[model samples]
Target: MDVADGVLVAGYRIVRRLGSGGMGTVYLAQHPRLPRWDALKVLDDRHDSDSEFHARFLREAELAARLQHPNLVAVHDRGEDHGRLWIAMQYIDGGDLAGLIRRGPQVLTVERAVRILGDAAAGLDEIHRAGLLHRDVKPANILLTTDADGSDRVLVTDFGVAHPIEDGVKQSGGVATTLAYAAPEQFGDGPVDHRADVYALGCTLYQMLTGSVPFPRTGAGSVMYAHLHEPPPRPSAANPQVPKDFDAVIATAMAKNPADRFASCGALAAAARAALTPTPRRRATRLSVAALVIILVAAAALVGVLSRTTPSQARPVRTPVSGSVDGSQWGAFAYIAQAFPDLLPGFPYGSGYEELSGCLPQDTKYNNVPLDTSLPIGTLFCLGNRDPVIDLEIVCNADRTPIQPGVALADFPEGDEAWSRPSGSGHLFWGHTTFTDTGSDLDGHTTGVLEIFFDRADRNFCRIQVVGTPTTGADLRAAWWPGAPL
Candidate 1:
């Protein structure tokens, strides 16, 4: 039965319908005696009539109500109104994780992504400690909002299908979890446990990092096949800005075997945190100070990577090199100038106008340029671009470290066509990337990106990526790489 606005169910006055899912419709309602509002969820007639559904709904209300954590949504009351069961929960004004992702992948930096995951993981672990498995874990069920103190508050909601951990009891039935994040055991007659939640958390983490489900497929069959047989897709492969260390983390979290997965969701979050922390920079004292090195080199058409907010306000934070080797001739910047004489040597200008440490600020509308990917690596080797809406930047190692080109290329995998050829002391790679770039003052709404990689593995290198680039594999030797030929 539909409850109109101003109608009272169990004494709580309904305001308006907030949203609806398969089981019920959630509404904003006035609390019976409190000076506040609550989210009122009423069961559908079909499910409310089922005795099994009645037990499960009661289980949801009871189990969730018993637990109290900052990250889990609180249940206040539940009762039957006109033969339909209903529940009142703390109303959250902010949106869910699915909404955050829809805003675009650019909004989810590594820091922001991990913070959200950490909150969700904490809530899941608490549930597990209370002897329950949140069988339904997905982006839509995760809520995101700001606390009254202006801090991020994430709430894990909708434990409608939570099942108790029954050891060694293998069961076969219809899948009760999201298909995209389902573990292999979930698709078979295997013993399912907390590790399944761990696997789903892995998928959720992937979505936060790359803004797409780990197994992005239109058909249920394809997603199921991927979960059951295929390997987990790397987050760094989807967004180059993501650190490569996360690849191994995602792999272990989404392992085909539940035993292979992390012991708990908290463990997975810890691994991800470790991945985000950069390894200590080499202690070699033979590198030049970047701040001292940067100056008006000359008016040149330079091309590279981009992350920008607004050109007028943002300035990149440059680190000054110290010690005797600050004047050293051996460096990534010097190597790029010698290798590509026509190509400009510089770094990236950060996005949405946020100041990035070590990133050289460049304007989006002007000839300003930012360097390579968000990876904390060597100096970027810029090519050519005059009035650029996008750019291509390749990194050159400061210590001349030998990064295996194939392994490095695997980090940026979802491309239309990826190929390589010999460049000065390295191999130059090119491909059509799958990174979807969006901005308000965009050139042409960013239909595609052309990625060019100058890999001097013995010297560690980077990809030259340009958003809003031409769709052409016709000429690799052409000046379509902004202005320079490969």
Candidate 2:
């Protein structure tokens, strides 16, 4: 089999070729046991004839597999089959830096470009720490993937074939068509080092910023001469929006002399980050030393007293969940409607709604209760609607667990924040916690959380959450609740 579609190599089922490079042809393959996919790099059989290269490939494959870093593409498994060397790596769905750059400035903003570079730098530094040099560092070698949580993760690829630091070799001597990213020493007699990769990274950043390579020379002789002699081009000159500091950064990274270049790829990336960051302005006003000392001393005294306390009553464990939860019954809605008819100013803005939800996903907005694992099981939702469509849901469970009073307050951190005692309630005593410190609703706006523990013998365990609009704890508690009237 040609290791084409439907062919199996070392138990990996080949799907299709992802890409090909000088090292080998890459194929998309399915793991033998897992349902997930892997990018399998199979070296050409022609190179397998060289015994020395074969030994090196296996040794380095093992080394690459040993590396475990979030920013580096993980090498999962490697083996030889039918006189071919193959290595399986993590498949990144987000495509390569070259492809992202091809999309131009509309997609690759300066902040995004710097962030991606920082991730690549971290991975590159890790490889260097492992005594390896990624000689061919370019946009094509950088891979991108997004996590399930909607965060972008950039991983470095092709480290399996990277040269060990001991292999001090002259890389780009005479003339080459692909010397666009080659360092100066590559075309000279001096031994090439990690600085070569730094130079290439600088070149990559240049292309990412300007939408074109630093030197677009076509002729082999011209390219060689440019790499050996020409000074690094300024990205700001091409794209005025690029910070001027980046020009100095590129110059240092692509410095003609190896010693003149940055000590490490991380340093270059850090410089780039600094270039992007605006200098912080010094605060003119200063707090008096005596006033600051008094505040600290008072806080220390309060912390000592509060630290000695505990919650009078231990809260009940969460309710057990079964199948999908029923939302049709206006569980908490009926109570809120009677208690505070004005809370949900009906139809004009947001739909009047409520849900008796089981353990909903943490991301769900309709279920406003802050679902801490330690809390009671039942959930009651109340929709007191507002603008850009904001809704409030208060989930309450009927759990009557008795405990002693005067146990002491559980926590008292610095600030005016304190758990106020629920006394003299008319209908429902409101307790509030804001989601600004917690997390946003599904719609990504800050949400506020509330848990109302009714002081009655039954002691209904209630949690209310405001979703959609950014809200303050003090403001929400004072205004949003439906207190006594019902």
Candidate 2 per-residue lDDT, tens place, 1-486, comes to: 135689998889999766554366678899999999999888756566788667766775777876789998888889987778888888887778765664445467888899888889899888888877777677777888788887678888875447777878654424221356788777766677777878888888887776566775323345557788888889988666688889999999989988999999899999999889856332213657687778779989988876675232232211111211122222333332223232321211111222111212222243444433323444334322121113444444424243222211112111122233343231222222333333323232333333333334433333344432224333344333423111
Q: Least accurate stretch of 10 residues (summed lDDT) in model 2? A: 317-326
Q: What TM-scores do the predictions have?
A: 0.58, 0.55
> Which candidate ranks first by TM-score, i.e. highest?
1
Q: Tens-digit lDDT track for model 1 on 138-194?
A: 777888898789767999998877877864435456676656677888877877888
Q: Residue 189 in model 2: shift from native, Å? A: 3.5
RMSD of 2: 24.3
What lDDT does each candidate get? 0.62, 0.59
